[model samples]
Target: MKRSYGFLLTAMAFTLVTLVPVGDLPAQQATASSAALPFKWEELTAPNFIKAVELSGGTCIIPLGVIEKHGPHLPLGTDLIDVRAVVLRAAQTEYSIIFPEYYFSQIFEAKHQPGTIAYGERLIWDMLQNTCDEISRNGIKKIILVSGHGGNNSFLPFFCQAQLASRKDYAVYLFQPPNDPAFEAEVARMRKSKMEQHAGEGETSAILAVRPDLAHQEVATTQSGEDLKRLESMKGVYTGIWWYASFPNHYAGEGRYGSREIGEKELNHQAEQLVKVIREVKADKTVLELQKQFYDESAQPLKTRQ
Candidate 1:
């Protein structure tokens, strides 16, 4: 059953109170002058929210994740935990409004898993679109989507592309960090297992770094993480059941090999990269200008240049 928006909002508020520390005064009661403005959306008071939108140049970040099984040892919210950690760290360095826990994403493949929360396709789309619309309504003009879940790779890009289908006052930007060969080499040198996709060494290490208490490395070997190769014969064919066919256990790599050192290194590197991205996005004006120009041209296609 889909949770109501009211319930979700209330749940999110509760989550903020429990997970985020807002000092002596409650978040809503804290004055802007009392302390430094927090980057979290839920933590900002009504008055400070307006200041945050302006302070961030109408820029906001929605760190996307999903609720699903991540092997046997890692928690279901591993992606959310790690992504939020990275985004919060970056936002502190380069201020931006970080939206509260957003896990409503594509996770149909993991529906068979025990802890997977697979919202309907239509609902997920509407939820994201409405969220963006509401964010823009709140005076934010530039929205950045930083996704942590691998399943949202295709979904998020498609959503960004669909923003062009109709005219919008705000611009949406997807964060795609460029590859660093040096960092890749360092990771390769540190990791013992070469096969890693989900709940693997890299992912487990990430959880270890972010929330070591939640990571149970001792139970990592309880399930098989080996690829079943169920669809090996189907070459050049893309099937919806590919992931399930390949990794029936929903475990893809050797989590036993995960180390805290590798986890910290990866998280730090990602946060550093995100800090640069936020800085760049805050200074960028070309996207919005081009969006407006395109919207105008698109509306009158007959007058477009040949």
Candidate 2:
């Protein structure tokens, strides 16, 4: 399969430096039982990788994240950190090979903020496409995209749709967990802040629960996360600059009001939902079968049933 040249070079360089040859390990360690294998792709031995692919039934997850600045209180990698935490928890229940930290995602709106590593649109697209290609090449044909960053909300779905633009041996599935009314109502009752977006109460609480040492709730009140409503008049029209125009400080919602209890509850709920998704995707064959049928039809439209 074709891959991005730049990504290929980087991947080659990484493999050369970090990976030990399968033959280098002792015979016993190289042939260890699958029960001792780790779910993380990077953590698995070269030989164990094959076992993981088979154990997972060719299912693998790419927990997508972006390095963007959160509010003053939360770390720049809050989204990635939080999302991975949930993915890891779910993987513990439903085994799947988890990709390493992937922060190549859309973060153009947060470019104005410090510590935001917003790559060009083409680079991010190529990186993700090539990453998926590389994973599939390794025998894991069912790739699951579980995005932690809100910025990827649009990009991921579009990527999945674009897969149909051509024929692919592997299938790409995006994990979109539906909201549970009971959970939302519980969150509403626990939520102290009225506005909870970005590094707000919900996000802050999440960080506190996962990595309390990094969360600085005391400084959360240092910045204002309230919307400026700068472009309220253009309600019907959509513009790229809308996020920056409203939240110039790149901070939204009150983080000081976040609590660990709420964060733990939210994370558990998300993990539970993800566990279910992983199981469903593992058992699913219709998507790939349908894609094959669609591709064959697309190859010759005249032959398709009217």
Residue 117 error for model 1, in Å?
A: 0.5
Identify the runs in model 2 with alpha carbons over 4 angstroms from their true place: 1-34
The weakest ten consecutive residues by lDDT in model 1 span: 17-26
lDDT of 2 by residue, 199-259 (tens): 9999988887777777888888898899999999997998989988889888889999998
The local lDDT score (0 to 100) that residue 257 gets in candidate 2 is 92
Positional deviation of residue 287's Cα in model 2 after best superposition, in angstroms: 0.3
Root-mean-square deviation per candidate: 7.3, 9.2
Reference-based lDDT, residue 162, model 2: 96
Clashing pairs in 1: none
User: 1-306, model 1: which lDDT tens digit per residue?
Assistant: 221333224324432321222244224423332345767898899997987776565789999999999999998998988898788767655667899889999999999999899999999999999999999999998899999999998899999999999999998889899999999998999899979999999999887777777888889999999999999999998989999999988999999999878988998899899978877787788988999999999999999899
lDDT of 1 at 184: 98
